[model samples]
Target: MIEKCSGNTLKEEFEDVFDDVLIDIGPLSVYYPPGCINRQVSEQSRKKKILRNNYLIKRNQLVLVRGASGSGKSTLLSLIKGIIPDSIFAVIEGRFQFVEPSANVFCVFQNPYSQLVCPTVKEDLVFTMENRGFSQRKMAERLTQFSNFFNLFHLLENKTSKISGGECQKIVLASSLAADPTVLLLDEPTAFLDKDARDEFYAYLAKLKGKYTIIIVDHHQEQILSLADQVIDLDVGIDIDLGKKREHTLVSENWGMIRGAIQENYCICIDKLSFSYAKDAKTQSNFCLKDLNLNIESGKIVTILGQNGSGKSTLLKLISGVLRPTAGNIVIKQGCHPLAPKEYCRHICYLMQNPESHFLFDSIAEEIEFNYRKRGDRSGNISEIFGYYFNVDIDVDVDLSRSPLLLSEGEKRRLTFLMAVLEEKGIMLYDEPTFGQDDASCKKIVTLMKKLREHNRLQIIITHDEKMAYSISDIVYRLCQGRLIDEC
Candidate 1:
């Protein structure tokens, strides 16, 4: 049962028996960059209203939060986790009461890297339990339970730096769950997971549904909706068609001719390539990739699908010259010889799984301008180009001056993708390009890939989203146990 009060009365009640209820709220509103009320009316454009007129969250409720990118879904999770107003700098209005002693809440942020503090997977899994003063025996028991369920035994001693993004996400989820929090907030928790791993997580979450109060924000609505007891939609009232599908009819005529001409020139060639981190890293010691051979031509989009830590991302790094091969060579652009790292990078744009690593500037506008300056291409204004591709007014849908760090995970992915492919690079390597994106944003990326193909750019994508891979890719390959297992 929910205990509700209005105005100041709610505040007085909160001081007393707050711990008796999971969450009780009166009328509430949230604004960013605090003191938004004090700013001039004209400066309304500068401030962001994060949430308004919130409702109560009862004990043992599974709440699904739905909204477009940059619609404050993550912000709401932060508020519930009691991290806002202190760590996140937001102004609050009205009153909301949580279970007394706020440490009972746990949050799995969209980016797994932010929460990882330990160097190795084993230590990271036990980090929260140590902080919470759990008994050593209990920590060991919980670790075994979670590690078995997540199939993370092989990665227990692995350095966090050497693992894949999906593996990191599993570690974070396991670490958080081992802490035994009363309230759990998940922000796209399964975004980086492969099919089997995602299903495992869903099964565990379903078993935990009524045991703890859960609030999740995710764009993968089909499965999540089945577990949701209630739905909260954050309406920003801006209708942006960022996900519109490309007109296949328009490109059907020219695609075959373009492919035939481009096939005459191979953009990237990998011959008997192999990679290993065994000596340097203390885990996954059987060599990450082995004897891999692949050839991709210009004007082609190839997708690599694999389970977590199956050397898919490692393949991308090898091709982009981020990691040197143990044996064999990678030849680029019909060249007889392999290119040096610097020369290889000049013709490549690699978008890593974590988009935050790509940002050097504070604001979106600054990042875009910096990319423009670096490329020495003033052929088009980025703002205009962005507006055209995304079908949204940049000033309204996205705040150009706001820190790129503040944008939602989906927004960050889009922004970095634009920065990567906007230039005239011959090869584009994307690792999990569509993770965290909504349908519209996903379509926009696919459409952009189609457009880039017309220009004869070679695109190799690593993804767990098989449906999306089939939709956009000219060829699909599956990696397993450090080898190319299948192709379609």
Candidate 2:
């Protein structure tokens, strides 16, 4: 339908450019800045297999592109969004044309933080909308429209960096909708959302299918596949089998399998805990968490699920000492010596929702060596261990010397995750551990969890992936209105 439409017709409807452009980035040689990468795999001397096909995204259809980590799903979006030929960072070597492309093509990247450019939510929207020449009155109208439309009015005053990753993803999406692009490209939109949020957002998108030409790239395929008008499996030229569809089961149905840890092996206790991002506000409605209590056991996998803004991340932060509790006690039973949250961080490894937040070094080589050096292992066996787990073609010993920031979202997650495992922290804390992971990668993580259980290590995962929680978790907790319910 879209291929038949003239550019004039689309511009008339969307008030933005909708050119019939075929993205051809082949023989497509791209080079990153010198000294940027140690391996330089993405930017090789010859044309590597990247967006090498002359693909035309059908108009007015929801096309989903699926592939494993580092597979050009994002780069394809970048090409369509015109980030390739326009940027100074990458040198392109092919004809990438956007025919009669007078209108803008906005993309909500996989990493929501990268797309958000302003300090606060409203400021970010205004900044995005104003770029398309929206007047003050029109921008204000859009700010209120999307914020309230997406149930984000309360967050208008919230700082972009201060909010949780899932909230940031919503804000970025809202900003994209407000921009009203002729082509709306979403890269893993549901990566940060909990199950409820993912369902709700997809339902909303299904309603907007006709209004916007949607192109989504996602690894989680259940609801997304059903919603797509057409599916494009990038790895192969056909729809990838996402396993059989299963009926949704009630979270309460598995209560018998959920068992609590014994007192003697108790890992941590949250006693009358409460936290408020704004402590001295004029009203009492601003509190995020209020007087919650819970207990974690060693050798058990605990999964926490909740809607967006349900204080799930807040609980993890409080336990990890990223944020101090307003009033309450987080006591850790560290080998018979009770320790405060701050003191207990040394014994626990907390993976942030955004993997980039967990990195200390710029290069992957330095990052890996830091772990091995701390243990005084100078042997070449470190690379062997890396190959065994990650199975990447690159020499595990080589630095790739690329900045951790330059790595793809999935690579960053794997790198930080790999380091944490090698460190052998007593307790592991994961916030959205399944983000940027495909089915195989998720299976690897499940296997890793089994290994952790054999050693009696505690794992507390704050996520929305129900299947993952059901697969490995011994205890499941659902967060609602600043409280944790032992659903299992």
Candidate 3:
């Protein structure tokens, strides 16, 4: 049975469990200094921050932490991992366990591409094993096993630069699992995948149920709710609770009549589209997409589904004008015009699956205002919007100069969404918008999409969540072998 203990007793217990390798933080508090003019700043004037108040993570449990964007989830993780500096953030009271100096702990970051730093897949996997003093034969055996298990064998000899996002993500998973860590922390591992690939990925994870201590921060609620042994809700600040299963029913009124309006207006059209990436001298060239014809209308949520490398995101890029088709023309009806890549930025906002890259400001407040200013728009009543949408009060008097990069993963995602909304674009393309959120946050996102649709905005979402696709979309399309097939 799980028991809550006082801070001092918990620290002592953690040290005993971890054999003195425990990370202890007492009354920790962090702050960011203001943007100053050539002078050092005082602690009192800095922005105050608090990660957790007397928090404790139990050993060897499949724990899932759920929180909205910018709720300090990532910071908490860093604190537990002993990566954050004591001087910056004050640890109110907490202790984290690590068995030994070489204790097994692996963290899969939100962006799989960022984690890949080696030349080739083999070299990347072997590098870690080699550093751990594993023999060549043993390393090779483990590499083969992991690669085969994750279906990454096909890309073993290929350059890391040439793999698709899904393939790259699988490689990261293989690398993390190859280490055979006692605890595995996953941050939105299936964010970049299509429906089939996401299903396969989750199946692989389900097989590892009791083998390791798993902690996943995810936004795909329906997929993980049944599997989660415990769900720590962080909606407010540091509210942890056990997960209880509840039956979910479809809300017919949730989607509203926006879909019917989209069918009447032909906003976007594609004719026989095809695209291919350049191939290396040693390998055969491959077509990412071929002979795809589709049309998207305003007010409708169109979902494109497929497996990994099936051109789902490529299709979204084609529609959003980020990519040009090698062989077909994209035609916009009279009311809409085909925008160039740069012009598309102003008209078509693409919310990337990985929200970390979307941040451009130092703080969440600044990030929102930056987007507002970019669009030449002003929100005189910012408090109303924040209260209605974010459920947070904005301190207009306080200067928000902290870096957005320091926010939690969920917060980053929310900030990105806010940025897109502030753009007031005619068409919005969301590539896996719900990556690292909880059940409540996921519902809020759906509600936000509905609000946008009611305003007559053309919203196209690329998602792996079949339930979400069916719930919000007016039309659904499937991509297979680089071809688009409509699902009636």
Candidate 4:
């Protein structure tokens, strides 16, 4: 049976489970520049924004922090966990507690790619334990246990970069578990997994529950609600409370007519496309995708699904005019197409899988407004447009002189998406738009997609979330071994 405990009681019990283990934080604040740019000028002018006040977390209790995309949820987690420098844009107003001696903490980021520092899976696991001075025997034993637990035994010797995103996620968790930390924090752990992989991953977590004080920052509530002991809602600033069951109504409406029906013109057409990246020096013949022919209709939602390295991203790049096809020609309707790839960016926006790469401005506000002004359209104010689309307030007076790189991962992604959407581009390409978001943020993204479709814009999203793909897509396509297979 599930037992509900108060925050104070939970904290006490947690400290008792792992003696001297506690996480204490006084008031903390984080700041970002005025625009979402990564340059030094923007970074220097970014101002601190208060994130948490008087926040304290004890051991054993599972804490789930929910908020919008840029709501500083991950920033708070980073501050509490000591991931970034205190002297940076973040300022701490109070002290924090973590047990000395036996206290160990591990954090798994939302993007598994960023967490991987080693070349091979087995080496990655061993590296962490080695750093902690674990005996060789103990490290091997722990590796075996973790590999068995996550069904990653086959991936032990595989190149970490060659593994699927889902498998990489499991590897990150395994590496973290091998550290034997008393406190484990997972940031959007299931963002990259397929349905089956997600189920299996969570099942493993269920078995390991109560053994570690787990704090998960995630957006997939349906999968996590029953498992979470306590949920912290961060809708407003610094107000934490218990979670309640929330029911969401699934609204069904034809999104095709949002832009007043699709025109007969072909927006993007690809014929016999192919691409490959060398796996190793010995195998110069390896290819990722082959013979991909697809057509993108005007003002419709199209989704592409595939396991990692199935060329979904490669296909997206080709469509967005980022990558040149080695064998095929991509033709756009003559009158409606941009003259070149650089110019094509004006008409087609591609939200890369890595959000940090797209940030070219300093502050979140400036990032949003820059795209608006760049489009040469004075149709709407940046604050009002993003506020209405995302259902979140954006204070115009807030500083727009900070660095975008200083924001949390989720914030960077949201800002990237907002910039793309506000650009009013005709064709928007989203590569895993829900990568590191929580449920609320995911819903807001869906809302934004619907709004764009209402304006008769074309959207193509590459994702593994079946629920999201089905919910927002008008058509779905699957890619396997670099081939496009239609799933009508």
Candidate 5:
């Protein structure tokens, strides 16, 4: 049975009798200093309160926390992981009692790459158990069981860097399970996974129900709600709206439409193009894109959909001149003349799937100002551009002094997108652009893409959102193995 205990006397009483109560948190409140809270602040000037009083967690309970981006769901997870006030600077007002040892709690971060420490998949999976002093036989047994469960046997010997984002997340999850933590904290675990892989992951969570205390922070409410025993709305500080559907309504000025400057027709021709990564000694699937042929024109939004590591990202890299083709050719033309490799970056811009990869400056203001000055666009103001596209005011909603690294995953994604738009390139490549965004932010992205299309800019999108793919795409291609098959 779950019991809520408040005050010093009740907490003591629960400690003596309620063995099931794994955590007893009394009138707790957490506050953060302005500009990302990088260090502890003595003065109480402009500090924002992230979490407030009376939060309780019971043993083996499945709790789901929901909120918008930058609403402190991740902050709460860090507190539960015992990282706040020590690893991350935060002001704590009250105490939280953990009945279980801190070692029994494991957190899987929102970004999978953050926790992937080992070089290869196999090593990463076993790294936790090795540090925990598990016997060799015991490690072997757990490895075999989880590898089979997650279908990660094929990727066992592959380097973590070579695998797709979704594969990296799966390996991280497997690594956490192998550690056998009693309390599992997951932050958007399925953010990078495709539909089939995501459904399979949901099934695994169902099977794992009641075995461990699982606290999940995610935007996929419909899929995860069935697994949650109790839900918390962090924004409201109460449990409500267990069955409310998320509404996405974004209205922004059509910046591209306002410009009304249509460029000369550009075309990308891929003729029997093929590319592959260097083969690993024991890897089963050495991902490659092979003998693909396509004709892409300006003023069209083309999307490619496939499973993880199906060479969707490889195609973008090759087209954007980041990687040369192993065989065949890709030619970008204005009217009829082909552009040289040296001129590729002038016309094409690539937004990587990982938002952090785009950051080069410490603060948001610096990052934006640097890119804005480099672009040398005298036509528009930076604040005006941000408002038109992202609907974010430069001075009001965002703290310009904060580090971009301190922003939430969704926030980072939006910032990267804004930087890309600032480049004013004719051709844009986006990889999983909607990965971390909430429904409302996702709508904003769609509106922006549509606006770009109206400006006659060619866009090549790599995504797994089937609904989104079908909605905005003029053409959709599905990649299998190394081959592209037209879906429409």
Candidate 6:
């Protein structure tokens, strides 16, 4: 629980929760200033070095930040959280004075896996309170209160590692709120959630209007924008005279319509497969997929759909050879005898939900080369095709010499998904392909899947995105209560 500041102190810092501007940025701008190493910036990295000046917001306001993938959306939040010139290197051009300092402000990261600590949800939520000197009884009281408020009472005892991506996000939010923050900042808060889950979260956020000064940086902002009193564009400031109107709605590109019918011819077969997680394994897969007989067909997109903690990702792992099945096997067959996922790496490529899970190189160019070399192909035309078809506005033109890990969350997703596409494997398995992408970027991915289908390749996606499943999938398989069922 937040320690109650004296009434005099509250009156000193916070404005009338009614009429005060909680944050004031006088000439807020950032630049590289001068650096010894890598002073040269590429077309993509150029925008990352600049932030439009004089972005302002008021108290009890929800400010939504939007831009293409690499356009400094995340960087702006980093600046506010004091992660910029204070921690990471960057030249600050202006001043940011908050009604509450860093202690009373909470910042959530884009990667859920990195943001969490402690093994169980109970411990993770209490760790911060303990650090703040709260009593054990007080910690338990607040945990129970916030858990109920956040609809997480049922999950308090679960292992944090076993929870789904969406569930993890909920725990992060609950833990942050337990700090009694006057300001809450979230970066891509709903990147892991589906349409239904996002809507549910938006509802929860709306109720916190006057309680906290909320600033959200997200690619999926359509549903949440209704709650935003201010919308800031990092690329361009809040300038109505510059073609950005305050009333404009941010809509994602809709590709719910497909051009042609799909044909079915089995390309991979899963014969009675099951898997269980080893303790603290290199990867986390708690739920199990058991005795699953499945067939993946060419010219069709097969999707794995389920609620959180249903082993949807585990099923993909079994197919990708990340997790060996407890019983049964997976076989890849194009025109030859069946081969397991390990033996048929050339025929299939798996893109993990966490793009960084598969990274093996230090630079973007090297990572691209590693992708092709691992598949035993030396094709040099991928860079060209990637440039030509890369319609994403997320700064795909970044310096190829930089590490892939240096790219923004959205850019990383694009790069990893492209690796599978560029290899042009007969079968590709994508786990949460739409994880960090905005609307237009998601449409581009869907369009690419359509093209792959036309080329008679097999595409299988594991996702919680219902819109994407409806847009690109030809068959949907649901993982329910440890069972995989073919729904359509």
Please tell me which predicted candidate would have the highest TM-score against the true structure. Answer: 5
TM-score of each: 0.81, 0.79, 0.77, 0.75, 0.84, 0.79
Residue range 123-221, candidate 6, lDDT tens digits? 888776766778878888999988887678788888888777788887888788787777789998887775566777788888887778888987666
- Comparing 2 and 6 on TM-score, the stronger one: 6
Off by over 4 Å in 6: 1-19, 26-28, 33-54, 99-103, 135-137, 151-164, 194-197, 236-266, 278-287, 372-397, 485-488
RMSD to the hidden true structure, all candidates: 6.3, 8.2, 6.8, 7.1, 5.4, 7.4
Runs off by more than 4 Å, candidate 1: 1-21, 24-28, 34-47, 50-54, 99-103, 118-120, 131-133, 157-163, 237-266, 278-285, 334-342, 373-397
Total clashing pairs for each candidate? 1, 3, 14, 25, 0, 2
**Runs in model 4 with CA error above 4 Å?**
1-61, 79-96, 99-101, 148-168, 238-265, 278-286, 334-343, 377-398
Question: What is candidate 5's lDDT per residue for 1-488, written digit by digit as tens?
Answer: 11223447345665656668776665444555454454312222233334445556778888887876766688778878888866876666555667666547888888887678889999999987887789999999999999999899999999988777788899989988888878999998998888899899899999888999999997777899999987766552221222222222122344542355346778999999877677441332444777799999999999999998778888999999989887789999977889998899888879999889889987776787676667565446656655555455545454566678877788888888777776677898999998877666777888789888888889999998887889999999999888899999
Model 3 CA deviation exceeding 4 Å by range? 1-60, 85-92, 97-102, 221-235, 238-266, 279-285, 336-346, 356-367, 370-392, 396-400
Model 6 residue 441 CA deviation in Å: 1.1
lDDT of 1 at 207: 95
Better of 1 and 3 by TM-score: 1
Residue 384, candidate 2: how far off, in angstroms?
Answer: 5.0
Q: Which rank order by TM-score, best down to worst?
A: 5, 1, 6, 2, 3, 4
Pick out the ten consecutive residues of candidate 6 with the lowest summed lDDT.
245-254
Residue 423: error of model 3 in Å?
2.8
Error of 3 at 458 (Å): 1.5
Off by over 4 Å in 5: 1-19, 24-29, 33-46, 52-55, 159-162, 236-258, 278-287, 373-393
- Quote model 5's TM-score: 0.84
Per-residue lDDT tens digits of candidate 1, residues 1-488? Answer: 11233545443545464343566554444554435423332243333433445555767888898876766688778777777765756666555667455547888998776678899999999998888899999999999998998888999999988776778889988988899988889999998888888888888889999888889988778888999987877655222233222221111222222222233344688899778866564343567887888888888999999887788888989898888888778888644555566797777889998889999986787787776557564556767754554465665555566677766677788888767755556788999998887766677678778887877788999998888899988999899888886577
The most accurate candidate by lDDT is 5
Cand. 1 TM to true fold? 0.81
- Per-residue alpha-carbon lDDT of model 4 for 328-394, expressed as tens digits? 6777653465356567765778898888898766566677677667746466776665455444433
Which residue pairs overlap in candidate 2's backbone?
A: 17-103, 38-400, 39-400
Write down the lDDT of every candidate, Cα atoms only: 0.73, 0.69, 0.64, 0.67, 0.77, 0.68
Worst 10 residues of 1 by lDDT: 244-253
Q: Give the number of colliding residue pairs in candidate 4.
A: 25
